[model samples]
Target: MTSAIGEPNAIAITFFLVFIVLSLGITVWASRKTRTAEHFYTAGKSVTAFQNGLALAGDYMSAASFLGIAGLVALSGFDGLIYSIGWLVGWPIVMFLIAEPLRNLGRYTFADVLAARLRQTPIRIAAAIGSLAVIAFYLIAQMVGAGNLIRLLFGLPYEAAVVIVGAVMLAYVLFGGMIATTWVQIIKAVLLLGGATLLALMVLSRFDFNPLALFAQASDMYGASVLSPGRQVSDPIDAVSLGLALMLGTAGLPHILMRFYTVPDARTARTSVGYATAFIGFFYLLTFVLGFGAMVLIGRDAITGIDAGGNMAAPLLAEAVGGTPFLGFISAVAFATILAVVAGLTLSGAATLSHDLWVSVVRGAKADQREQLVVARAATVLLAAVSILLGIAFKGQNVAYMVGLAFAIAASANFPALVLSIFWKRLTTAGAQSSMIVGTVSALLLIYLSPTIQVDILHNSGAWFPLRNPGIVSIPLSFVVAIGVSLLWPVASEARRFAELERQLHLGVESADELT
Candidate 1:
């Protein structure tokens, strides 16, 4: 079947080939140094703040942000701004609450931080499950997005596209480790931001460089009612719930948090986050322009008739603005964006399974670096396979919806434990464990019983779980469970140890050589 945008342009294909080669070369070069598990997992804790910041942007701005947000804005006007605000607002929480403590406490994963003041095995197991669940959901979403984009741009079969993405992403994580993945994200971020800026400028230029007029025109195009803040829909409850998930979810994400570990110290971690916030905020503001650009310039009828997935809006707008060559460039950029994100997710998942679960939990402190890297590589391949299968099974579903589900789970399961582990003095092993379990299980069960799963997955239309996202209910539930469980089973020994570790995590810094 031919793509709605016509055959993939040769320029786009050529650009894609060049990217694939460059990414592969970087992976090969980085793999040589990935002899130790520390190098493989955290890039030897050597990445600078600025470099890590750009890479963080690359990891954070997945296909959902790049393609999904623009499409949502083009489709729903102010409703799309909700996603932008949700995503952008979460960074402040990371910068102030989570960043320094996370950097100070953890060695490899978020599990490292939470389990620092708790038992190693059970906490590691629970956190690993949460991390893996979130990672798997995220990976599936990226894989599905990649397949759809490939089909849209190049007229490839869905299976073939999934295979290609899987192979490339696997190579990236297996050979490159954090170093290769970090560079890939950096390059992709630069291109994505550059392309978005260009597109935003072109869009603004179309209205003679007037921002107000552009919005006014967009309001007219989408309808004057849409311009009103509360005019789009009657139900703000679900909107609020979804927003909570996206906003808090960003800080809780394993991949985003893992980026901080690669940097040198808490100060650099904070600096990197600041830079990421600025970069991401600027980019999201441009998304508002680009979204409105599509609404007014491309028109609703033209885009609605295309794929309903909404991933194609940016590429389609590029074609409308700059002809085939520019469209090709945007398409190639989108493809590279998916590859970079998948690499990050896969690496994080592999680290959790290999380092936290296997070496740290199963093997204890006795396992050597060489043994851990081997387990990490094996886990990487396994994760890639599962994601590819899920992607193929769930093709053509809404990318944003799946990604939102992942966020909901992350916010519910990971956020509570992480926040409490760092700040609350009364937090015990029982509290952290119960919170993780309740949050993870409750969110998953809620999703399983949701309308999407019942109607779409089970082919039963009558089932209704009114809340599309579980964040509203499950987040509070997690906190409650943690606190309640802690009171019921108080551990004075655990509490004292937690206080001491908290002090060290907040103030103590080992020598640079002590890290490795």
Candidate 2:
């Protein structure tokens, strides 16, 4: 059954095989020094700013960004540009506001920042749950995307593709930990950017090196009447919801924030973010070319017949221009992208579970470094299994939609707490906990009842919820809840402790030996 799917080109298979081997080798080498919990969780605080920056890019540019944005632009024109813009704009907020502060306060996870001066148990447990939810949804989306891409490119059975991805990603996290994961991300980022650049050049060369000619050609191909700025958006509210989810959502992601902890200090963290922003912005601009290339070169009818979910736009374009070789290379790159992303998600989830939940909550601040490392590895395996099951369950769904939901949830539950904790002096732990709970619950409830899920998944004629994403509503609700609660219970002692921690985090002073 696995072999019955179309066979990938021999060159493509070889390239993919080599990537897998290289990634695994890096993981094995990284594991040599994984002797302490700090090493397993934070790479022993040894990762440089530039390397961490690349890793952050690798983590941020998931299959959703690489494939989904291209597909969206191919299908929805100007509406797709909205997604690209939203995603790209969020980084400035992350860099200027969140990055250095998060790095200064956090050692392992986002929870470390939020739970820093708070009572350990409740806040840690809540944060762990939020992190796990965000990671699981993200991992499943990537795994499902991997399976679908393998099926499309190699003609492999879905289960076989998923199992293969699961195995490789598990090996990445289990053996390599943060060090291996970072290097794998850097390698994947380089390959992804290189591939996009080559494809973009090929696409531009088709228009005889004229940028205006490319857009003009795309408009003509799409028909001049539908090429207007707002033509693709059928519903204004849905468009706004989508934008809010992509923009705010990027700032809130746990895996992305965790990358800051890998670097040495606040200055390095800021520099890393600047590099990431420039790289990501450039790649998104390239996506516009690729999307329009598909529209003109491949045509909508051909692409729809070839790809049900539209993820095939970029790969199909590769095949059309460069034939079997480019197709194979693109396929291999897509596979690598999925593997790197899932590994990062698994590692983030594991850290939240082990460091935040088990070590902080269950062990009651008494567990040694060795004991914590063991817990983290165990949690990694458990999260991997959970993600595999989810991948299988949501097999044929659009990967972009699932990823969007994860982003929405992350933005709602985590973003407010993180922002307020750093900037607002009166933010109590109770406020933080309430914000997480409210944001998470509201977003999940809204999503479950949304038209996309309620009507589409449940086969209902009417939707209980109107919005496809809850970020616009739920994110604000979380902020309000946190502020309201904090105002009511603004204790002076907690405020003083929080202020001191903020000063320490901003100053980069190391006080607690227990902290990494």
Candidate 3:
């Protein structure tokens, strides 16, 4: 399955170009409809629940889910299922606790929800910081996936592949905004799910259409240990930490939270989550089969020889089952997956900068629609550049592993503040700010000291942080700080507004002006 030395794959290249051209066409069409800040950030709040569900699923089932998790399963066996389970469980938390309230209270970003009942200035600043950090880390994982995928499939240099992805993503967000990004995600989602389903069925047909038989074959080939838990999460503490990050982090993802605003009302927001959870859960099931299929059909030696991180397993598996044209289709789907997810991330980051920071803070919510739109586009370009550099800098890391770091930050920083703001009264602006700042800083600092960085990347002999993920410690610390600060420094005004916030949360926003 190895590509020739520095030679482009003609089939893959043709498929990739076709996808690019089609996506750009969609973007051009969307740009014509994108004139207002509402349109730019939330697609005019006009997306139906079904379309938004597909879009949300598209955003969640990213390169990390499609390529990284499949590769992890191929490499680590049963331990890789942990990532899938962790991510899937978080949707219920979003559906029940966050999604409806988020849509009703906030207009553009999560900070809007927080600022609904609290002081705007400090809250927006802290939230923007937390959000941008999460987006940055998540963006790195996606960009890394894109770089490796393009390099392997198209024979481009890794840096060049990264640049191409960044440039294209920038165009989507800069012009078409959420309208374009949403449709791109929808298209990518359908293609990815179909490609994965087809690939999984092809593998299962060889094993009598019974998934257990595929697992059995994998067990026989790699030994029974491959069907059981292995060393990837050998330490109890690390297992708990990673679990907390993956499960809770999904509720905190800025781009995901932003999706609720694209839908019309609170009820639609909840419905969309229901649809998304179903799609995502099914997709994850297919990945389990796809992973084992790769291990049994392609063998570990061939899989690892192609890419040490095992990121190429799914595409390689596609080729094994269906040959070169199938490989081209699956590879293009992977590229589309990367592009759509990064576009969503970039748009969310732009919203935080333009709506939360620029319009709300810098101008004291005085900026016109035109100015806000300009700032958002400018921020998109900035984030795209930063993401491109980050992708090149962290060239060879396993993207799934990189995403875990992002989840840790999200769980620690964004999740706690958001929950406290919506569910806990007596949460002062000071309390929310402190929680976000502490959660973000502690998670990042611990990550730097963890083995993933101190040893793996820095070449140090030992890591100061014992666990690979800081979620076990950082998540609780964030909650504790938030509770302590609220209890000790209560704000009567914020507490009073909780009653009004509650009314809006359940009853929905009454006026059109409220949404704007």
Candidate 4:
């Protein structure tokens, strides 16, 4: 069956091109001011709390949240809400535990935080590996989503779609750096929120602005079971594992963590998260209405007929209620969503490569601002090319598993090392390094053995691993390893270093000038 959107749609093309042009304009304007390493990496720490807040919302709310959740809820009813709740709950974890200290202690990348109290070279390497892994997996998901989405919406070939996205994303990050990326995210967020609000309002108007009435109508068509938990999450243990990954992963995501540096200080960082939480939570609520609206207005048969994954439900609903123009608008919004996210991911990856690996490791942290900026741009180009290739290579595969794997890795590897470094003064260099390595390796190994890859992807009859996501085991195991290793291998001098770092985290660093 061919998708309804699997043809050349002129309206969709126009909307998408307009977005690309506008973003490029912003990148050009930003490039002029992107002179120093700080400007290139953290927008010179010049962005206001409100702007960073919108950018944070744009970074966190991906195409998955916009189209995936709406489709999931449209298809699976109450069970679909699980994904939304899992993602939303993670923000509080970020707000309370991560945002301030991260803003205060780090200059550009999250590795700076870990390097504060631990051995610089080894800690940076470990942290860089974890950051790159998360970025790679997350980038794959965004790239694949972009290729497939653009193919369906604009009738572009999959390869061409990916290259286009990569090229534009490179232009944003490679030249304009964080400044351009942040504004791109801010614009996309506003468009997305506005589009979703309009879509939800149109959906609710059909039932006189009553969500329950829409639910009743959907239940009448699909039966009462649609109003209850369904097959979206059948396994109790797998559900818990997935929940753990989603809850903890947000605090560890490099792109999300990188946003804190774009703000001025720790207090503004907290404000950004608060605003981000409000925006994200409200958007998810609108997503609920959009889901039920699709179920009732468009019907399951129609949605599934267009796209078997039900991903077309939101776009189809837009077309059904508001005709082709609105569908074009929503489709363009979805594409913009992918572009915004990948830009942030690409920037994070570049930071790990340039700031952490090149400047800090190879150059012994002696590289000047000019050389560092050059390496950063070069790294951005490299990552962009890699992303385009990966998207084209994984064209028809089920890359959904990669998204979950990314979250699991973030939870296991990055989150453990970060929390321990910040709070546990006794945590030795060996303990931190071991925890990150073990966490990263264990999560990857378990997922490879799990039913997700073994039976589902590889078509094996049975599997050694029981759960789909590794978070249930990997997260706790990481913490245990960190604590146990710290106890056994005590480092006296490291404890004193933590005292100094803790003071800086509590007070403030003042500016990027004070970082070095």
For residues 1-516, what per-residue lDDT tens digits would candidate 3 score against the true structure?
A: 453412466777888888889999999999999999989999998999999999999999999898888988998899988888889999999998899888888999999888989999999999999999999889999998898888888888899999999999999999999999999999999999899999999999998899999998898888999888889988988998888999999999999999999988888899999999999999999989999899999888888898888888998898888888888888889999999999999999999988999999999998998998999999999999999999999887778777888889999999999998989988899899999999999999999999989999899999999899999999999999999999998888889999877988778867646643
Give each model a TM-score.
Answer: 0.96, 0.96, 0.98, 0.98
Task: Please give, for residues 402-443, the per-residue lDDT of candidate 4 as tens digits.
Answer: 777889999999999998888888999989998999999999
- State the C-alpha lDDT per candidate: 0.86, 0.83, 0.91, 0.90
**What does the lDDT come to for candidate 2?**
0.83
Task: Report lDDT (Cα) of residue 177, candidate 2.
Answer: 90
Model 4 misplaced regions, further than 4 Å: 1-4
For lDDT, the strongest prediction is 3
Cα deviation in Å at residue 417, candidate 3? 0.5
TM-score of 2: 0.96
Q: Is candidate 2 or candidate 3 better by lDDT?
A: 3
Candidate 4 lDDT score at position 385: 92
**Ten residues in a row with the worst lDDT in model 3?**
1-10
- Clash count, one per candidate: 0, 2, 0, 0
The alpha-carbon deviation from the true structure for residue 60 of candidate 2, after best TM-score superposition, in angstroms, is 1.0
Task: Report the Cα lDDT for residue 483, model 2.
Answer: 96
Q: For model 1, what is the alpha-carbon lDDT of residue 451? A: 70
